[model samples]
Target: ESPNDHINSHSINNSINVISDDDVAMEDVIDADDSAAKHEQIIVKWICQRCTLVNSEHSDRCDVCSSPR
Candidate 1:
């Protein structure tokens, strides 16, 4: 039990890795959620001006008031 005392030293695990400032970029983390919505076929519903009824955009005339588009 002097200055040269030894307790059977050994290694624990691998070396620790560090990331530099130039390693990653902000643009690399782009969101992929909006792409699905953009590719989807969304139906545009229009409101009838005559009776103020909500109708599907596919129909040329209003279903409630029969108003011409």
Candidate 2:
């Protein structure tokens, strides 16, 4: 191919590569956000009504009598 054609093709290829890299980075960021949200949802809190005791942030039941929160 002619020099000008070769240069244009290389430029186009570089542009495509840059765009693909950006898309991958953006996807990685979105995945991280989704993972953080899932972790937050999995953490449950329990507060005892009788003695007013707050259990661990990850506990689903009160520590005193195992009552559902």
Query: For residues 8-66, what per-residue lDDT tens digits would candidate 2 score against the true structure?
Result: 33244222111122112111221332333321123234456656565666666678877
* Local error of candidate 2 at residue 23 (angstroms): 38
lDDT of 1 by residue, 17-61 (tens): 322232221222212433222222233566677886666667789
Which numbered prediction scores highest in lDDT against the true structure?
Answer: 1
Clashes of 2: 0
lDDT of 1: 0.48
Indicate the TM-score of model 1. 0.37
TM-score of 2: 0.29
- The per-prediction CA RMSD against the true structure, in angstroms, equals 22.4, 17.9
